[model samples]
Structure formats: structure tokens, C-alpha cells
Target: MGSAVSLRRFPSPEERPAALRVCRLPGVYAPQADTRLLVAQVRHEALWPGVRSLDLCTGTGIVAVAAALRGARATAVDVSRAAVAASRLNALLHGCRIRVLRGDLDGPVGRERFDLVTVNPPYVPSQDARAPSRGARRSWDAGRDGRLLLDRICVRAPGLLTPSGVLLLVQSSLSGVAATLDALGRGGLRTRVVERRTEPFGPVMSARAEWFAALGLIAPGAWTEELVVIRACRS
Candidate 1:
């Protein structure tokens, strides 16, 4: 494992592949640790020309662009129009031909299957039972237990994959890593945690620390969370 790459500013082309020049649009989820972690796993995959890939909840479409750079024909989907636009802009900026769609997780893709599916959805435990319809918070506010989207992805991902397809997903430990694995396993996919990273709480988590602690989601004074990348395969 290497040091986490900060997304405070877009990385220079010299720092990363030109295709990864992702822009952080307002109200769109920025590429952060989880995004980089998932992209790293994307680079490790055996991608080739015509390898179809899909990225769900693709905020800035960084993951889709990463797959495209590796010769995978990528499609990105997001419920937010801003996210769809950002994904398209980033793909165009990198000259990567990615199909960007505005829809809920895995919804726009319909019955279309792919060789690979990647996701970095909202997994933060929130007081609200329903996710926000708009604003930056919409990018990470998962309902109560934070499994709102994660659970749906687990159930839907298996059907989205090719016979030998793979799914790479990232989420925080607070969101129940074992539950995700179990859900994917129940869906008939073999799953494993391929990467684990401990990071300090960001603004959102920090703001809700007390409430999370009250709910016993974290230790009273704990201010950090583990991010894990789980890989599920249809082998």
C-alpha cells in the first residue's frame, strides 16, 4: 500500500495518467482516498481493448476514466446531473470515449452487462433516513445505517457482470464491511477485501461524530475510519 493521494487539487499530468485529470465540480463527489483506491485496483485489472466496464455513482467519473485509459470501453452513471456532466467533461478532457448517463445506481445501464463494474457510492451513516435530493451532501449521505446504496449495489452487481466479470467497490468500515461481503456472497459472487486504508475523519464525518458516537457507530473519541476496497468476481 502507498500513501493516499489528496484530491485538494487536480493532479498534474506528470503525477498521474493524463486520463485521470478529473475535475471537482460543485455538488459532485470529488475523487478522494476511496476513489484513488478503486482506481488503483482498476489499474491492476487485466484490461484490454473492448473490455466493457461500468462505473456506478460515478461522481466525477474518475473511475470510468481510469478504466478507459486502460483500454476498457467504459460507461458511467450517476443520479446527479452535475455528476453526469462532470463525468462527460473529464472523459472528453482525457480523450477517453466514455458514455455518461444521468440515472440512479445501475439504473440507466438497464440489462446491459459488463466485464467489470466499479462503484464508490454514498456510505456515510446519516441521521436522515432518505438521502438528500440535491447539494454536495447528496454525494455521501447514506440512509441511517449507510447501507442504503451499498445493499442495493450488492444485490444488483452480480446481475450486472459478465460470466467472468469483476466488481470493485469501496466503502468505509463504519458502513459494515462484513455485511457488504455477506450480501455479495449471497448474490453468488466470491468476495474479498483487496485493500484497506485508515483515514482521519473528513468534514462531514467530523460534524456528525457526536451523533455517530451516540449511536455507538464509533468509539466516543475516535475520529478515523477504515476504507476498504472489496473485489467480487463471477468466476
Candidate 2:
């Protein structure tokens, strides 16, 4: 896993493979740039067989499955029932022994500690002040500031990790990367943005670019957004 190889980036129709390995069900947030970035970082981690890995807001469980395939004991949690079901199906399809649970973030896995944790939760800032607890909106419609779930993860994940454990969280820079670093830093974790990738706006983000710009979330005509993967290791 030295000198990480960027996994297949899907930008153009011709660039993506005709047959996909990921089993994406409808309403389940499909793997995009953030997912690929996190997966790439996951591959580079010093993982061992039987090491415990947890995926928060696991979605299709691709990240958790990748950890299991790498010989770690992986567990994934999601708030959406469809996401949990899709995760289970995809894990089975990929022949990975991943435990898929339906719950919000780490709620279902009370007091469970892990060697590594991966988070790609809902981080998009939406007009709605209150984020939806159910339906497809829960996949990305975070609160006005977009740290609805990110804040919780920063507060809880540090305590959920083993002494030598590390957490890998991926979210858009618009959601406030500096805020994330500060929150995790307060938790006594050694944190830093391990990876940064600039990607063109997706449909959801593109639609909100104007709104974000109007609110000064971005510069006018800033059609692109940067995604970052933060690596926070326990001190």
C-alpha cells in the first residue's frame, strides 16, 4: 500500500468501466469521489487480519467491505434502512464478512472500540435548518452549517478508538475542514488533512452552488469544490 494508487475516478462516461463492481441500489448514495478518496486511504493503512474496523454512515458499505477484503473484521452502521439493506447485499455480493447494522452513526455499537474507523456521513449544507432523520435526504441533507453529523463524529469518534487507533473522515471543504480539525484537535487526537482532491460539482452540489455563493459559502462562479480526507490518530 506504499505510494497509494488512485482508484478509478469516474468523471467521464468513457472513463468509467462498463461493468461496475459496486452493487448500488436505488436511493442508496452511490460511491463517488469522497468514497474513492477514503477507500484509497484505507488501502494505505497498516491493517492486520482480525483488526477491528468500523464504518460510520456506511451507505453501501463499500469502505467496510474493502476493509474486510483486506483481512480486517469490519462493521458498518447506517441510519437509513435501505442503506443497511444495500450494505448487507453488497457485502454478500462481494464475499466480504462485514457486519451491517441499521443505526445512526455509532449509536448501535455502544461502547465498541476499533483499531480503525472510517466516516463519510451526510455533510452537505442544505437550506433546511433541521436535517431529516429518515428517507433519502438523510443521505446528504445536513443542517444549515453542514456539520450536523460531522460535529457529532468529531466528539464521539475519538473516544471510540483504541489507544493506537486512527479515524479517516472524508467530507467536502465547504462543510468546513478547519472546523473539523479544530473539533478533533480538542479531543486530544493528532489530526491533519491527509488527502485533498478537487472535483467538479455533482448535481446536488451544482444545484446549491448559487445558494451557497449567495450565502457567502463560496465565491461567485466557484463551480468546483474541494473534498478532503482527515486522518486523526489517537495520541
Candidate 3:
């Protein structure tokens, strides 16, 4: 597999590939650095024509579509209606047969096993104890310390994978990479940091900088954060 690609910035419109372009309505999360970063790692996986793949928290369904294009039988799940619509729309636009479902994480898939599972779930720390149930903020806001979805995934992902399955997950450093490693380790999966990229604070992170520092989530006066893609496998 290729080494982790360092993230820089979102590509300009003209630079984006025509095949992967998507239509996003307001309240739906647009594909960003995290999405592209995850997609890059997805390309590195050994996906055969009929491999079963699942993408949780699929916003625009870009990751699922990518897997489908590679000939994997891909399924995507999301809780938000808008996100579900956007995911289905993108799948149709790409002419990929993706089973897009409207439900939270693995709940929608139920007892199904997959060879590969990918997720870019909400990981941003929010003062609110629970992520917003309704709004665009639902795409990125996790409860205090930002582990709400991350923690659940670490616990649940192992069960969702087949015996030899692999999982690719992306999240920010502010969300506690070590905690994730430990959780997945306890879950019996061998894990590694496959990719790491430092990105400047975006609007949300910028606005929460002071609060983050106060809560000791970030160093005082720090404005940059690292995003990491973690690969876990059940051998």
C-alpha cells in the first residue's frame, strides 16, 4: 500500500475529478479534506469485484461511490435525511449501484458483515454534551471531547467486519488518537496510523479554539490540527 498522503487544502473546482464531483444541498456536509483523505486510502485497499463494503456516516456518499467504481458491492448509511438524499444522489450521479440507507452507523446494516468498512463520522468537540440532532452541525459536531461517535465506532466496528475484514477511519487529533488506538486494540483489531496530515483550523475549529484551549483539548494559541487515517484489520 502507498504511504499516507499529507493533506494540504481542498482542490479548486477545476482540479476536482469529474467522476467524483457531487451535488450537495444545504444542511448536508460537503466533501472536504477528511473525505478526500479517506478516499485516497480507499484506493489503496485490495478491493475485488464483489467485496462487501460499508461506509458509515456517508455524507455525500463519495467514499461508497469510490468503492463501487472499484467494483466493490458498497453500502452507505447515514442518519440525516439530507445526508441520505445527498448520498443517494451522488451514487446515482456516479452511476454506481450503492445501497444507501438512512440510519445511524451499523444500526442500519444489522448482523451484516463486510470485507471493508470506512467511516468519517462526527469528531469535533462541542460544548454541547450531545451532538446537534438537527442541522448541518450534525455532520461534524460530537459531544464534549469529541469521542461520541468515535468511541462507539471503535467498539462496534470490529463486530461489523468479517473475520478478515479491514476498516479505514479518519478523524482529527483533537479527538484523542491514543484513546482510539487503545479502544480498537481492546476490541481485538490490529491498528496503525496509515495517514497523517496537518491542517490549519477551519471556521468551526477557529471559533472553538479558545474553548478547546480552555478545556485543554488544544495548546493555547494553537491554530493547527492533525488529521489521521487509521487502518485496522481482523486477521
- Give the worst 10-residue stretch by lDDT in candidate 3: 1-10
**Candidate 1 wrong stretches, greater than 4 Å:** 1-19
* TM-score per model over all chains: 0.93, 0.91, 0.92
Q: Can you write out model 2's per-residue Cα lDDT over 50-146, one digit (the tens) per residue?
A: 9999999998888898788889899999888777887887778778798888887889999999999999989999999999866677889889989
Error of 1 at 108 (Å): 1.1
> Per-residue lDDT of 91-115 in model 1, one digit per residue for the tens?
8877889999988888888999999
Candidate 2 lDDT for residue 37: 85
Q: How accurate is candidate 2 locally (lDDT)?
A: 0.86
Tens digits of lDDT, candidate 3, 1-235: 2223222233432355443667676677778878888988888899899999999999888889889989999999999887788778777877889998999889988999999999999999999998898988899999998999999999999999999999999999999999999999999999999999899999999999999999887899999999999999977
Report the alpha-carbon TM-score of model 3 versus the true structure.
0.92
- Clashing residue pairs in candidate 2 are none
State in Å the error of residue 117, model 2: 0.5
